[model samples]
Target: MEECCRLGLAKSIGVSNYSCAKLSTLLQNATILPAVNRVELNVAWQQQKLIEFCKDKGIHVCAFSPLGAYGFHWGTNAVMDSPILKDIATAKDKTVAQVALRWVREQGAFPIVRSLNKERMRQNLQIFDWELTDEEVRRIRQIPQQRACTWKEVVSPDGQYKSLEELWDGEI
Candidate 1:
C-alpha cells in the first residue's frame, strides 16, 4: 500500500492498531514511510512513547477513540468520567468530551470523534476554539494511566498475540 501510494495509485497509506515495535519494523524496511497511524488513544490510554516515536518519524498519530468509547465492551469512560477532567471542564466551561478532545490536540495528534446527535456533534467541533491551560495539562498528565482498549479476545495463551505484553510489545 505504501508503494501504491508512492506510485500515485492512492493518495496516502497508513496503518491501524500497530504497536511501536510493529511500526519500528515497518519503518526499518519501507521505502515510503507511513503517513498516519490510527490508534485507540485517549487521556487514560495515552500512548506517549508511541506518540513521540511517530512524531519523530513524521507519522501523524490519529486517535480513533479520543472520547474513550465508553459503550464498547473493551472501552471505558475513564477519560470522560475522571474527576480531574470533570474539574477541568467545569473550570473551562467545556464538556468532558471537549476537554478530552482538546487534550489530544494539545498532544499534537488529531482526534476522531463520533456523535449522532446534532448538539453533541457541535460540541465535539467546539474543541478547536479553546486550549487547555498548562496547569490543566499537568493535572491531566498526572491521572493514573491505564490502557482501556486492550484487544483481549486476541490475546490468549493460544491466540496470535499470546499475551497482553506481547500484543503491546510491553508498552502496556
Candidate 2:
C-alpha cells in the first residue's frame, strides 16, 4: 500500500472497524499512518477515547451507522427511540436523527448517514444549521450505550476473534 501511494496509484489509505488498540498496533509497524478510521459511532455509542486518539494521531474519524442501523437485524433502535434524544429534539425543534448526527459532528468525526428516501436524506443534512448546547452534550454523553452490531452471529469459529471482546479488542 505504501508503494502504491508512492507510485500515486492510490492516493491514501483508510481502515474500518479499527479500534484504538488495533490502530496502535498497526501504527507501530506501518510505514504511513492511516488517513481515516471508520467505525460505528453515534450519540448513544460515542467512542470518545478512540476519537481523541485518532485526532491526536492526525487520522480523521468517520462514523458509520450514526443512526444506529435501526431496522437491520444486527442493529438497534437505541438512537432513534431514545427518550433523551426525543426530548432534545422537541426542545430544539429538530428530529431525533438530526440531533444524533449533529452530536456526531460536534464530536469532530464525519458521520455517515444512509437513507433511501429523499426527504429523509434531506433532513439528515439539516443538522449543520444548529448546535447542541453544553448541557445538551453533557446529557447526551450519559445515554446508555449498547453495541448494536455485535458481529456475534457472523464470526467464524476458526476466526481470529472467538468472542465480541476479542473482536473489538475490548474496546466495546
Candidate 3:
C-alpha cells in the first residue's frame, strides 16, 4: 500500500464489507483516510455504529442495497405483509417502498437502492420533499437487525470469523 502511495499508482484507497477491527488496522497503517467503504446498509441492516464512526472521521460510507431488497426470501414478512409501513405511507402519502428508501436517505450517507421497475425508479426519488421524525427514525432503527444476505462461502466453517457476529466485530 505504501509502495502504491509512494508511486502515486492509486488515486485513493478504500474497502468493502470490512469490520471496525479491520478498518482500525487499515487506519493504523494508512497515511490517508480511505475515500469510501462500501457496505450493506438499508432499513433492514443499518450498521449505525460504523456509520457514526466513519462520519466522525470523515470517511465516506456508501450504502449497498439500501431498499432492504424486496422479493428476497429471507426478508421479514412484515417487509411484505405488514400494514404498518403502509399506514406510515398513508400519513406521508407515499409508497411503502418510498418510506424504506427515504429512511436511508435521511441518514447522512449515500444509499445505492436498485429496482427494475420504472415506477419504482420515480418513487424512490421522491424522498426530498418529506422526512421522518426522530420517533420514526427510532422505529425504523428498531426493525430487527437482520442481514438480508449473508455469504457463508466467504469463511471456513470452523474459522474464528465463522458467524456474522464475529465478522461484524460484535457490533451487530
lDDT accuracy of residue 29 in candidate 3: 80
Better of 2 and 3 by TM-score: 2
Model 1 agreement with the true structure over 30-123: per-residue lDDT tens digits:
9888899999889998889999999999999999889889788778878878999999999989999999999999899999988789999998
Better of 2 and 3 by lDDT: 2
Between prediction 1 and prediction 2, which has the larger TM-score?
A: 2
Candidate 3 structure quality by residue, lDDT tens digits, 1-172: 5568669998877788876777888889888788888887877687888888888878888877776656666544444333556667788788887787677677777878777889888887888898898877767766777776675455566776687777767766
* Alpha-carbon lDDT, every model: 0.89, 0.90, 0.74
- Listing every candidate in turn, what is its Cα RMSD in Å to the true structure after a full C-alpha superposition? 1.3, 1.2, 2.6
**TM-scores of all candidate predictions against the true structure:** 0.94, 0.95, 0.83
What is candidate 1's local distance difference test score? 0.89
Give the per-residue Cα lDDT of candidate 2 at 140: 96
Per-residue lDDT over 78-160 for candidate 2, one digit per residue giving the tens place of the 0 to 100 score: 99999999999999999999999999999999998888899999999898889999999999998998778777874666987
Superposed Cα RMSD, model 2? 1.2
Regarding TM-score, does 1 or 3 come out ahead?
Answer: 1
Report, for all candidates in order, the number of backbone clashes: 0, 0, 0
